[model samples]
Target: MELYGQVLLIAMPIFLVAVLAEMWYGRWRGKDTYRTMDMISSMSSGVTNVTKDVLGLSISLLTYTWMVDHLAVFDIKATIWTYLIAFFVLDFQGYWVHRIAHQINFFWNKHAIHHSSEDFNLACALRQSISSFVNLFTFFLLPAAVLGVPAQVISIVAPLHLFAQFWYHTQHIDRMGFLEKILVTPSHHRVHHAINPEYLDRNHSQIFIFWDKLFGTFQEELRDVPPVYGITRPSNTWNPVKINFQHLWLLAKDAWRTQNTRDKFRIWFMPTGWRPADVADTYPVEKIDDLYGYVKYESKSSGALKVWSWIQFGITLLFLMYFFGHLGTIKVPGIFLYGGFIFLTVYAYTELMDHNPNALGWEILKNAFGSYLLFSTGDWFGLNHYFPQGLYLIAGYFVLSTLVTAWFVRKGITPDNFVTQATKSQSYSTLNTH
Candidate 1:
C-alpha cells in the first residue's frame, strides 16, 4: 500500500509537468479553448476508469502473489541481474499482451473500453477494464514462474511501468524530436489512439516505440496526417461497466450468429470491428473524424485574454498537482472522494473554460455524494475502518446522468438561438422587400 502511495506521489508531479507542457503547446498552437465542461467530462470518465483499473490491479496483484508463493519451491535467487532481466522480460511480455489485446476479439472487447473516449487527456490513460488484469497478469507471471523472480520484485516493477505510461496519454505535447524515434511520445501514442484508417492497429508499443517500428506497425504522425480520435463506435457515458463490456457483448453475439466455426474463429482474431459478413459498421466514423479533426487554419487570440487564461490555467495546474499529490496520503470517508475530486477538477476546469455545461450536474452529484460520505457516515458505514469505497462509486451513475442532461442543455443552447436569429433575419428581409 505504501508503494501504491509512492507511485501516486511520483505520478502527480509527472502529471503536473505534462499538464503545463500541454497548456503551453495548446497556447502556442492557438487552440487554447481549455473549457471547464470538457475537462470535467473527460476527467469524470477518467476517474471512473481509474477506479476500475485499481480494482483490476488489486485482483491481478493477489493472483501474482499466489503465483509467487507457489513458485518459491524453485528458490529463485534475487540479484541485480535478475531484476534487470525481469524488467525487460516483463516489458517484452507486455508488448505481446498489449498487441494481442488489440488483435484478439476477446481481449479487444476489454481493451476497446480505453479507446472509446472522444477526447485525449491524461486521465484517459487510466481507462481500462477490470478484466484486463487477467490478460496482464497471465503474461507477466510466466516470466516470474519460469525465471524464478520473486513476487515482491514483479509487483514493484510492474506498477512502475504502468506509472511511466500515464503521461503518454495526453494531447499536450507534440513530437519530442529524437526521443520520438525511440521512446513512445505523446505524438507516437496519439497515432495509436487515432481512429484514422491509416492508423488503426498501428503503434502498439508499450515501453518502447522500437517494437512498432521494427514490426512495421509504426506510422509516423505527419502534420499533413491529421488524427481522428476515438473508436469507430463511441461509448456515450462514463459508465465503466458498459464501457468495458459492451464490445465483448457485441463480439459474442456476432460469433454466435456466424454458422461456420472458421468464421467464428476469424471474427475473434481479425482486426477489431471486422465481421464475417458486412453489416454497415455501427460506429460513426464521421463523429470520430470530427473529434480528432485538426484545422490547418489558425485562430487569432486576444493578447489580454490569452495571458489571463494562461494565468488561470496555471493556478488550476497547481491545484491538481497538490490534490493528486496528497490523494494517497489522505484517508477519506469513501472511494467516491477520490473519484469526486478527479471529476470536480476536470469539470471545474472545463466549466471555467466554457467547453461543456453538460458535465456540471455529474460534478455536483459527485460532490454531494462525497460530502455525504465525509459528514453523514460514522463508523457504521465503515468510515474509520474501510472507508466505504463502494458507496462513493455510486457517483459514477450521477456523473453519467449529468452528462445526458448536458447533451439536452447543449442542444437547447444552439437551436433556440438559431431559431430566434432566423426569425429576426426573416423579418428584416420582409421589411426590406416591402
Candidate 2:
C-alpha cells in the first residue's frame, strides 16, 4: 500500500496536468467540454477510488500466485517476450470483463459511475468505481497463469495497462488513420461512451481495437450520427458514492418487492436493466426515449457556489496528497481515520453541489469529525513537525467550511431555482427502461 501511495504521488500530478491541459485546449479551440460541477465530481470520484486502492480495501477471491503454482503447463522466463505476452493476456481479460459489466445486472452497479457523466472529457475519465470490493474476476488471467507468468510481472504490468486507457478518453483528437484500425483511439472510445442505439455496448476493448473486431462487438462511428454520451438512465445527481450503488439499491428493492420467487432470484443475473415484470409494471422507472430531445441533468448554481466548490475540491486534493505521503508514518487505524475523513469531505461538498437541503448537516458532521482528528492528534496527523502552523490552518478551514455551508443554507440555495433554462424547460428524464 505504501509503495502504491508513492507511485500515485508521481502519477496524480501527471493526470491533473493532462486534465487541465485538455480543459485549456478545449477552451482555446472554442469547444470546452467541462462544467465546473461535473469536473469536480469526476475528480472527487477519483479521490475516493484511489483512497480505496491505497488502503488495500479489497480482497481477491483467487490469488494469481496460487494459479501459477498449480496450473502452469510451461515455465516462462521473465523477459521482454513474457511482458508482451502478459500485456496481450491482460487486454484480452479486460475486454471480457468490460463486456460482462455492461451485459449483467448485478455487475453493472460497480460500473455505472463511469458512464454517469453526460459529457465526455478527460476529467470524466477519472470517474472510477469504489463499490467493487471483491476481485471476483481474477480468473480471467488463467491464460497468463497457465504460461507461468510471475505474480510480480502481473502487478507491474496491470497499472501500466490501466493508465494506457486514459489518453484515449478525450474529444480533441480526431480519428487516427492507421491507428484507428490497430488501436482504441478517441473516436472508438467516444462510441463506447455513447448512449446512442448504434453505439451502445459497441467497443469493449481497453487498449487494443482488435479484441472488439475479433469478438464481433465492433461498431464504427457513423458520419450521420453524432454520439450522445451517458447511460440510458441518467444519474441526475453529482454524488459519486450514491451513483456507485444506485443500481444495487434498485435491485435490492425489486428482489424484495417481487412475488415470483424465480423472478426474484433471476433478476440479478438476467441482464442489464432487467426487472421482474410485476415489479416493472407496479413501480415503473423513467428512461430516456427521445434521446435527442431530452434535457441533460443540470442544477442551478450561482458563480459564488461554483467558486466555493472548486475551493473545496482543491483543499481535499491537498489533504489526499498529505495522506499519501505519510501512509507508513500514519500506520493502521490512523490511516483508516485519515481515509474516512477524505471520504466524508467528498460526500459533504458533493451534496452541497447537488443543492441538497441536508447538505448543511453533512457539512457539520464533516467538520465535527475533522475537528476531533485535529484535537486528538494535536497536530493534524503529525504535520506540526513539517510545518509549524499547519494545524492552525486546518482548524480555521473546518470553521470556514461550516460557516460557508451554513450561509448557503440560510440563503435558500436550492436546485429548484429558476436559473437553469433546462430545468425550467423540461422535467428530469425517466430512470430504468429495461
Candidate 3:
C-alpha cells in the first residue's frame, strides 16, 4: 500500500510538471480557450477512465500475486541488471499484447474502450475494460512464471512500468526531438490514439518506441497528415462500465444476428466494428472526423477565476497526496480507507468526465457504501493486525472522504454544466441553419 501511495506521490509531481509543460506549449502556440470547460471535461474524464484501468490492473495483480506465492519461485539476489532485463522483456511482451489487442476481435472488444475517446489525453490512456485482466494475466505473468522469475519482482516491476506510462497519454506535450525517435512520447502516443487510417495500429510500444520501429508498426506524426483522435465509433459519455463493455455487447449482438458460424467468428476476431458482410451492407457507416472535437458550452469565468480554479485543484491534489501517504503507513484501517478513497475518487471523476450533473446521486450512494464498510468492518478487512492503533485511521478516512464529497457536491454541476449547454447550442444552431 505504501509503495502504491509513493508511486502516486511521484506521479502527482510529474503530472504538475507535465501540466506546466503543456501550458508553456499552449502559450507558445498562441492557444488559449475563451471557454475552459472542455479542458475540465477532458481532465475529469481522463482521470475516471484511468482509475477504472488501475482497478482492473489491481485485480490482475492480486491474481498474479497468488500464482507467484503458490509456485514459490521468487528471487531476491538478482542484480539490478537482471531487473532491467526483466523490465525490457516484459515491455517487449506488452508490445505484442497491445498489437494483438488492436488486431484480434475478442481482444479488441475490450480494448476498444480505450480508443472510444475522441480526445487523446493522459486520462484516456487509462480507459480500458475490466475484462482486460485476462490479457494482462495470460500475456505478461505466464512468461515470467515460465522463466522462474519471482512473484515479488513481477508484482513490483509491473506497477512501476504502468505508473511510468501515465504521463505519455496527454496531448499537452509535443515531440521530444531525438528522444522522440527512441522513447514513446506524448506525440508518439497521440498518433497511436488517432483513428486516421495511416495512424491506426501504429506505435504499439509500451515503455520504448524501439519495439514499434523494429516491428514496422511505428508511424511518425506528420504535420501534413493531422491526426484524428478516438476510435472509429465514439462512446456517448463517461460511464466506466458502459465504455468498457459497449463493444462486447455490440459484437455479441452482431454474432447472434449472423447466420453463418464463420461470420460470427469473424465478428469477434476481426478488427473492431467489422460486422458480418450482410450487416455491414445494411448498417450505414459514419466515420467521425475529429474525436476530440466535442460540443463546448461557454464558461463565465474570467482569466483570474480560471487560474483560481486551477489553484484550488492543485490544493486538492496536495491534500489527496498527504491523505494517501498517511493511509499507506496506517494499517488495519488502511483497507477501508484505500477502498473507499478509490471508489469515491473514481466515481466522482467519472461524473465530472461525463459532463452529467446527475452524478451527484451516484456519489452519495458511493459515500453511503464507504460509510457502511468503515462502520461495519471491525478488522478493516484484514489490515487490523498490521497496526497497533487498529481502525482509528479508517474512522478518520471515512470522515475526511465524507467531507470531501460534501464539498464536491456543493460545487454543483462542475465544468460539464457548460458543456451540456454548448451541446444544446449546437443543436439549436443546426435547427436555425436548416
Best by lDDT: 2
For residues 1-434, write the lDDT of model 1, one tens digit per residue.
43454465566556556655665776686554233323333444444444444323434443666665665446667778767766777767777777887877777876786776555666567565544544444645565666677777777777777777877876556678899877889888888887777788888887788988777789887676666656776654334445667777777777777666787777777876677663234322223344332221111222432343344345434434444444444445333455455445444433323323433554465456545554565322343444466444434534543554455345443322321211111221121110
Candidates arranged by lDDT, highest first: 2, 3, 1
- Overall local distance difference test of candidate 1: 0.56
On TM-score, the candidate that comes out on top is 2
On TM-score, the stronger of 1 and 2 is 2
Q: Clashing pairs in model 3? A: 46-123, 74-150, 105-269, 118-291, 118-292, 122-169, 332-383, 332-384
Which stretches of model 3 miss by more than 4 angstroms? 32-76, 121-131, 136-150, 167-181, 256-266, 278-286, 289-360, 370-434
- Decide which is better by lDDT, 2 or 3: 2
TM-scores of the candidates are 0.62, 0.96, 0.67
Instruction: Report the error of model 1 at residue 282, Å.
Output: 10
- Model 2 TM-score is 0.96
Q: Across residues 277-313, which tens digit of lDDT does each residue of candidate 3 receive?
A: 7766666454565434543224343454355345434
What do the candidate models score in CA lDDT, each in turn? 0.56, 0.89, 0.60
**Model 2 lDDT at residue 87:** 96
Encode model 2's per-residue lDDT on 135-190: one tens digit a residue.
89999999999999988899889999998999988877887999999999999998
RMSD to true structure for each model, in Å: 10.1, 3.5, 7.4
Clashes of 1: 12
Clash count per candidate: 12, 3, 8
